[model samples]
Target: MKKDDNAFGVEEAADSPGFLLWQVTSLWQREIRKALEKYDLTHSQFVLLASTMWLMQQGEPVTQILLSAHSKIDPMTTSTVLRTLQTKGLLERKEHTTDTRAKTVALTTTGEKLARQAIKTVEQFDTDFFQALGSKLGDFNKKLRLLLQQ
Candidate 1:
C-alpha cells in the first residue's frame, strides 16, 4: 500500500465503476427531483404511489407488503410513506381482507389523479433524459438489468 494509493486499492475515484455509478445516479435523481417538484412529492413518495396504483390495476386488494415488493422499496419505508400519502388524502390503509395482521392499500380519488398527472411528467422527462443514448438505449438497459442480476 503506497502512501498515495487509496486504501481500497482504486487508483482514482474517477476510474471506479461504483463512484461513476453514484455520480450518474445522483445527477439523474436531481433531474427527477426537479420534475417532481411541481407535484409536491418526494421521489420515494412518488414511487410508492405510482407502484401501488400500477399493482392495483393488475388486480384487487393491494397490500403494503405487496406494494413494497413490487416497487423494490423497503417495507419500513413503504409503510412510512403510505401513512404520509394517507394523511395527504392520496391513499388509505385498511385491514387486509385475508390477512389478519397485514393492511391493504388503495389510492384515493385525488391520489389516482395526481398519480396519473405525475406519471405523464415523469415519462416525458425520462424520454428526454435517455434520448442521448439515441438507438442504443435497449443495450444500455440490458446492461443495467445484467448489473442488477449480479
Candidate 2:
C-alpha cells in the first residue's frame, strides 16, 4: 500500500487507518462522556453495570471473573468497580455456594433500580446520537464489526 506523506513531519494521518479510527473514536467518547455526566457514572462503569445485568438475566451465578470477561475489563479494575458498586448498594458480593474461591455478584434492589435508570439514560443518549444516521446505523454497525474482527 502507498503512504501519504504531505504537510506533517510524521507520516500523513490520511495514510494511517488506525489514526483515523482513533480520532473518530476519541470524538465519540467525548460526546458520550458529556451525556453520561448527569448519571454520575463513567463510560467504563456503565459498560460493566450493563454487562452484569445482561448476564444475570441468563440465571447463572456470575462471578467477578465472569463479569470481567464479559465486559472486557481488567480483573483488578473489575474488582475495584464491583466494590464501589457494592458500597453504593447497587450490587452485593457473597461467597459462592459451590466455589469457595469465588464470590457471586447480584444486583440489590437499589442496584437494580439504578441499573434501570442508567439503562434508560444510555438508551436515550444512543437514540439521540444515532438519529441523524437513521438507516445507515445498520451499515455502520456492520462495518464496525468487520473492523473489529481485523
Estimate TM-scores for all models: 0.90, 0.82
Residue 17 of model 2 has an lDDT of 77
Give the clashing residue pairs of candidate 1, or none.
Answer: none
Alpha-carbon RMSD of each model: 2.2, 3.3
lDDT tens digits, residue span 75-97, model 2: 99999999988887788999999
Model 2's TM-score against the true structure: 0.82
lDDT scores in order = 0.92, 0.83
Least well predicted 10-residue stretch by lDDT in candidate 2 = 1-10
Model 1 clash number: 0
Give model 2's clash tally.
1
Among all windows of 10 consecutive residues in model 1, the one with the lowest summed lDDT is: 1-10
Best by TM-score: 1
